[model samples]
Target: MAVSGVLGVFKDLDTAIAGVDALNELGYTRADFEVLTNAPYPEGTFGEEHGMHRLGLFPLVGAACGFSVGLLITGATQMAFPLVTGGKPLFSIPPMIIIMYEGTLLAAVIFTVIGLLFESRLPRLGSNLYDPRITAGYIGLLLHAPAEKVSEAAAALRRAGAEDVILEEQPAPAAAKAPQRKGASA
Candidate 1:
């Protein structure tokens, strides 16, 4: 099914909030629309509740995997080679500890990068409906819905005091394109 887009611009914070409420009254949930602004707003400003993410545990998991690999490598080398030096035992504890620590740190970083990419849905940015004026002061509300509901979404935004409502008619998917610079003449 094809999903159309509606971009609503509000004159102020109050109007934007009202527009969001109107959208909700019309049966649109948090997932159906999004609020876009230049500055960060407090959580739940538009009565939207986001799901909690479990990204923090990624580092711990990564560290554990790294530690195991390090232990296997160090222990195997000591058992197989049995190199003795400076009256020290064939199996040294200090060097093995250093190697294990480094491996653990490296794994943690690798896992964190993977987790961030997965959690953020990287490389899959959707067709965003926004106006260049959004950076000037207006608040933008992007609504995504089935093709049949485009009018209803626009109406809801209007009823809530949206200053402008635009229907996006972007072309079909293509190669990734860079965002247009604000002041560059094209």
Candidate 2:
């Protein structure tokens, strides 16, 4: 389903924060809006609660994958090369343990990277609700509301001191390749 929203641009931090609060007072939940800025603002700077992230399982999932891969390699190698030493067993656990440990670590790292991308919503090839001014020092507050309520949201943003207000039909999805900056030599 398509989500309709209003984007409010504020030139100052305080005004931007006020805009966020105004949105909340307008019956918009925390989930209904997002803040965009050229600079980092500490969490809750705008009375907006930063959403809780669920990253509890990424590491465990990664470790499990790594262990399985390690085991597969260790087992396959041992079977492929049956070495005989002085009364030594053909399958040794000590060496395989090392391989398994390394594998687990490698998989965990890979999975962590994948999980970060998922959490961060990377490779956005379809975002449509961005303003070029955001990169030029304008703080933006984008509020998602029902199509019927778009006008009301925009008005609230204006009352809260938004420098510029833009009503977009839907937030555009981000593109896979982030767009190149303007005015730089190709």
Candidate 3:
């Protein structure tokens, strides 16, 4: 039982910010709304706008794990089969550093990509609320409002110079229901 409402698109960031500010004055907090921009904007551009919290930390932690594994493998091999070259020690520190560095970076990049995909909820066929026009240098402000307040929110957006207002419906779940059989006992 959730719904999303879309305000008219704005051609510039300034208009977007102004609309957000107006919404705030009307008692709409950051948690109840989101702004979609075609280009990156500075943090806090919309008077306390909050960005999505990232899950990038997973990749960094994974990289540390990889580095430790690499170091253990390299060191153990050298110890198991000691190679004596003149007066040099059987295990060397300089060569091991290089292997550890490469392994750590490789693992970090792999995990970061995986984390990005997981966080984004990707591979979806479609989204119910999307406007192709927003991709063409337009910014969209989406608000979550009670059913009774949708019109009021849309009016506020229009007053702040929204080009158009529209109601968006969430897509119905795609599960198929079994057909009921006539005269069949429960």
TM-score of each model, in listed order: 0.79, 0.75, 0.78
Candidates arranged by lDDT, highest first: 1, 2, 3
For candidate 1, give the lDDT: 0.79
Ranking by TM-score: 1, 3, 2
Candidate 1 shows a clash count of 0
Where model 3 places Cα greater than 4 Å from the true spot, the runs are 49-56, 121-127, 171-186
Comparing 1 and 3 by TM-score, which wins?
A: 1
User: What's the lDDT for all of these models?
Assistant: 0.79, 0.76, 0.69
Candidate number with the higher lDDT (1 or 3): 1
lDDT tens per residue, model 2, 1-186: 456757888888889888988988888877778888888878878666776775646878889988998889988888898877566787877778988999888888888888898887766554345567898999988777777787888888999898788876434544536633222110
Question: Considering every candidate listed, which one attains the maximal TM-score?
Answer: 1
Give the worst 10-residue stretch by lDDT in candidate 1: 177-186
Task: For residues 60-129, write the lDDT of model 3, one tens digit per residue.
Answer: 8878977987899889988998987666788987778988888888888888888888886665333234
Candidate 1's residue-wise lDDT over 1-186, tens digit each?
778778888989999999888888889888888888888788888887765777888888999999988988998999899878678898887778988998899999999999998886655466645677778888988888887888888888888898888876653344334332111110
Window of ten residues with lowest summed lDDT in model 3: 177-186
> 1 or 2, which is superior by lDDT?
1
